[model samples]
Target: MKGLILAAGRGSRLLPISATRPKHTLPVGGVPIIMRAVQALREAGIDDIGIVTSASSEAALRDVTLGSGHLTFIRQAEALGTGDATLCARTFLEGQPTLLYLGDNLFGDSLRPVMDALDGADAVIGVKRVPNPQAYGVAVVEGGLLRRLVEKPRTPESDLAACGVFAFQPRVLDDVADLPPSTRGEIEFPEALTAILARGGRVRALEFTGFWSDAGTPRDLLDTNAYFLAELRPRVQGQVVNSQVTGTVVVEPGAVVENCTLTGPVWIGPHARVSGSAVGPFVSIGAHSHVSGASIRDSLVDAFTRVQSPERALSRAVVGRHALIGPPGEEGLQLVVGDRSVVRL
Candidate 1:
């Protein structure tokens, strides 16, 4: 089966953090979000991958995902919905079974089982139990099979939110192409799956119990970063001078952590410098970024960003690349600054 990733979404929920860069290019644990989806598909033995991207984000997405695999980039002309995005890549699929994964969603579960389930079924949807099913496309399972797929239902019949991964047969593409726009005026993937069920096609619902996040907001980015960081093995490839690093932390080559207290489950990217700071317990400093005299926790600092906030505590912040963040006032700063932006509080 081939793999198709939908990375063309504008990431409106991510807001200013996604203002300059594609949300899929944003890093979680020093790796781009789209790269993680690529890895997941690769691990499932799908080498021929196709990434559907918008014209504006194609360059950025290509830069981060270059040489990742046998990847083909298909540009979606308009900001269509997920089903429309998949239909745009029909030529790449070439009538073969395709595994469609949303680029922004991150799940810790393996796709091997989902692929295996597709052996007997026409489609298999990866689902996770979420609190707010109204905000997501949900699956209704009856007798261990997916009975219906609903998008943002007012009264959700099931808590199983469709978690952005689906194994579809070759004929599913025709069904997607035939689907009309939903009430929201977009051709949603859920409607496509429901159409498959209506045609007597079997669709299995595979529930994922592991960590899963859409990563479409600053808070979700921090939470997803922390989840991935928690699985990080302790490795120090950089220089640590007068620093106390506890727990699991990965200091990549060329990164220097000096006079800092890293409280575990942290990732310091290559060439990043952290000095005189208290970082960690879920933090990822991007490559070539510099953070000095700052007390940061549960934050993601993008590459090439300069944060010089002495005696200030920054938490739950997502700082973009090439930006400058100054020291904050008494209340401290929890910001979502975009690329090349300056925040001097």
Candidate 2:
């Protein structure tokens, strides 16, 4: 089966970081967010992947998917809603059954169950019970079928929020073709789902008990790193020396560390170097990044970034690629830097 990954959003909530790179390219657990999505699809026996992206992010997507032959990239000229982004790939889908994933969501369970469920269903969407359903697109399920879907209803009838993983037969494209723009001037996917349901299409909701996180904002990104680390740390390999690592911590191969304290639920990417730094308890250091003479807690540092001497960063901050930080003279505590930015904190 083919897969479609929607990664076209500008991620305004993420601000400076999203200004330079797409949200899908943000690092989680030392890997790009979209890479996790791709691996999940591949594990589900769906190697053929199509990514919907805006023109600004086309190059980044290509760079990330390099050497993955089963991947295809489609450009969505306008930043339309989810429906319009999916419609951009209608020609590529070509009447084939496909899996759809939101680029920002990190999944813990294998997607095979949803793939298997598509045998008898026209569409299958992954759902999870959220504490507050009013903030999400919720599904009302009766028996095993989805009775109704409300897009961010003020008073949700159910707590089963759509987890953004979907399986749809090609015919669903017809429902999206004539969709008018939503209030935000983008084609909304929930409307397409509603249309399909109205046409007597079999839309099934699969409740997932396993871990899933939507990293839409800075806080969500940090929380996702913590969640995945807690669940998948033992399986990852890395050397721990002179550090206190609790929960799930993944240190990739070829990473160097010395005179540093590392708390659990952290990930240090391949070839990363950390020296005289204190990190952890919800932190992710990207590939080839360097942190020296710094103390960072609860932050995501992107690839090739350098946190220079005497800097201290704390709580829900994202540092982008190729960033440089000079010495900090005990002045500030929080720093959020974008890609290719240089700052003397």
Error of 2 at 29 (Å): 0.4
Most lDDT-accurate candidate: 1
**lDDT (10s digit) by residue, model 1, range 1-345:** 899999998887777777877999999988999999999999888899999999999999999988775689999998878888988998889999888899998888888888888988889999999999999887899876999887789999999999989998898888898999877688887677788888999999999999999998777888899889888889999999999988999999999999999998899999999998999889899999999989998888889989896556888878888977775556866576445444545
Across 1-345, the per-residue lDDT of candidate 2 in tens digits comes to 789999988888777678877888887776778898999899999877999999899899888877767688899998888888888898888889989898888888899999888888888889999998998999999987888998899989999999989888888888888778887887887677788888888888899988878888777888887676666544345555676655666788888877888787778888898888888777888889988988887888888988887434655667778987656446745566445443443
Q: Clashes in each model (backbone N, CA, C under 3 Å)?
A: 0, 3
| Highest TM-score scorer | 1
Q: After superposition, how far is residue 318 of candidate 2 from its true place, in Å?
A: 2.4
Candidate 2 Cα misplacement greater than 4 A, ranges: 232-249, 311-313, 325-345
Which residue pairs in candidate 2 have backbone atoms (N, alpha carbon, C) closer than 3 angstroms, thus clashing?
81-186, 81-187, 246-264
Q: TM-score for every candidate vs. truth?
A: 0.93, 0.88
How well does model 2 score by local distance difference test?
0.82
